[model samples]
Target chain A: MFIKLAALTMLPVALVGGVVANSSVMIVEVDADDVHIIVPVPLSLAQVAVAFAPDEAKYIQMDSEVGEYLPYLARFVDELRAIPADAMLVEVIDGSDHVRVFKEDDVMRVQVDEGHGTKVNVRIPLASLAAMVDAYDEEENMFRASRLVGALRAAPSGDLVHVIDGDEEVHIRMW
Target chain B: MNRKLLSLAIGAAMLLAVGATAQAQDAGWIHIRVMEDEGTSVNVNLPMSLISVAMELAQKHAFDGDMDFGDEFDGHVRFGGRHDVEIDDLRRMWAELRDAGDADYVQVQGDDETVNIYRREDTVFIEVDEDGDDKVRLQVPFSVVDVLLEGEDNELNLVGALTEMANTNNGEILQVNDGDTTVRIWIDANPQG
Candidate 1:
């Protein structure tokens, strides 16, 4: 049976919470036919405030002016939550220093620092994902197949991590 | 040297340069739009020159590594070796099978039954039969089939045909209604002089 390509419009939803100050990292792996995304989520408001509060100065002022920071933090969390979980079977592995998030039965795992961030791992079929994304926006569809493979090919061996600006809509890095 | 001859030659050369630039600007483009009943739509624009460049690049790297086409049209067509053989290889294989008369209908093994693919004149038919019962039959035009078959060769014959049709037929290239979704592709040519 031919699968119908549908647009995926589910944005991340916000989990009600306060903001905390913390640091965190996200990792993603793109394979031949699948994509694995891993993100660390901080449970506490202080950690969430610190990890995704736009910037350090704004984060400092967040405590003084709570209203201005709450909405931004909520939006960030919502975007993170918007990462599609339907296409993946998720598992959360909690540790003392870090949390490990991965797809069920996936052998690959990333170590996370404890109390730093929450880790979320999602595995998606690359072809299906590309088709779905293409159904929505053809111009951006190529990134799923072409740019992804090119980036994976160019990535150096070893645990290399490159941090882009945190304020970006999707702040994912490869490790 | 005669000044008149020199002036004429300079003027001719400038005219040729301008003609070349105009030709470059007049090159055709394909626009594909997919729409669903749910009010979701997507638009894609593909330049003919870019497709030509990608075809050349694919030919160049056909034996080593992977050749990626358009970013939005995306995906790598890997060549060389058995393990990395991609859709391009499969197309050639199917075409050869058809040529050899062994594939008037190709049988695909399913979980509990067999699916048969055969061509009837201009339409390719896919029929699924499970446990001695006919399950499903689908007929698709040869135009769409040609797109898939000729895709391995990096030729956009279907798009070219659509471009020609759009040029003549009031900008309506072709539209296919599969269930509730409609897919339309046309050529938005550079305005004529």
Candidate 2:
């Protein structure tokens, strides 16, 4: 009876999630409503659970933000995606430091600024964004690098970070 | 007689100077862009036609590298011969290309679009556009081009290709793959070795 109940419960979840061909790489299809600040450490789920157990409040905030702005951001992301098709709004907790810009064709107009030491500017023209992304990949030695938040998540514990300097130097920082 | 000898000496020096200038003009610059799934990088001063021929040869001989030549163009010819042999020949051929009297810029097709690469012995320079040299400049500065030449996660593979244009860099959406350590790449250029 217990087995039957478990199977019945799992069946719907599996169907809803879609039967992914390979379970090794779990491809989660997150819509706008599911947006969240994801810490992309290469840690196992158990390790992640242990590390994040004390940060339940942080997770809650992320979830709430995702729930509220995901739809709007998704639509917004889609709209701007035509030109800068690969550009995305990475939901991040520390994005307070980033500047936001909106692009009209090749022109990028800065929309937001928190006055962080670094230009926390968002809203890049597709061309500039493409150039930046390309420079980052060549600098970081990756086929492609994610946005700044994704970079942060990848090396959460490391203070030494890599950034493209004037689209030339991949400056490695000790902090 | 002394003045006459001095004039002859000055003429000889001028002729030598002209010879040096002519020698400098022997090699022309070509722009080569190496684009991958992640992004595109513009390399300048490279003999575009020579590299284009090398790329053609690699395609014909199936030479494997960070940037695969086959998938670059629609009408590209596949490299069917031995990889090592063909790559060596192409490299040799590239070295032999004479740049004399050619335009300072030769546009070559990268893995994606046509890019101009300025070739130099130690570094390759790239500009955004022919005219906008002041606005954009990138040096082929990496010392480890080998990493770019050979990689399992390269764009040639299905996964990398699919994810090539998947995400944008405007600090918005983050695709957190809790698998491999994801490197945030800005430019799509071969790793310099």
lDDT (CA) for every model shown?
0.38, 0.30
As a whole number from 0 to 100, the lDDT of residue B183 in candidate 1 is 51
lDDT over C-alpha atoms for residue B101 of model 2:
22
lDDT of 1 by residue, A4-88 (tens): 2222222222232222122222244332224334554322433334344454322222232334333343333332233333212
User: How do the residues A1-175 of candidate 2 rate in per-residue lDDT, one tens digit apiece?
Assistant: 9999999999967753442221112112212333422232322332334445554421222222234333333333333443342221221222343333334444334433333433322233333333333323332233222232222323222222223223222222211
Please give the DockQ score of every candidate, comma-separated: 0.01, 0.01
Going through the candidates in order, the fraction of native interface contacts each one reproduces equals 0.00, 0.00
Give the range where candidate 1 chain B is weakest over 10 consecutive residues by summed lDDT.
B15-24
Give DockQ: model 2.
Answer: 0.01
Candidate 1, residues B9-87, lDDT tens digits: the string is 3442322221122222355544555555555444444344434443433333433443333332222232334455455
Which ten-residue region of model 2 chain A has the weakest summed lDDT?
A: A22-31
Evaluate candidate 2 and give its CAPRI docking class based on DockQ.
incorrect
- Position B30, candidate 2: lDDT: 22
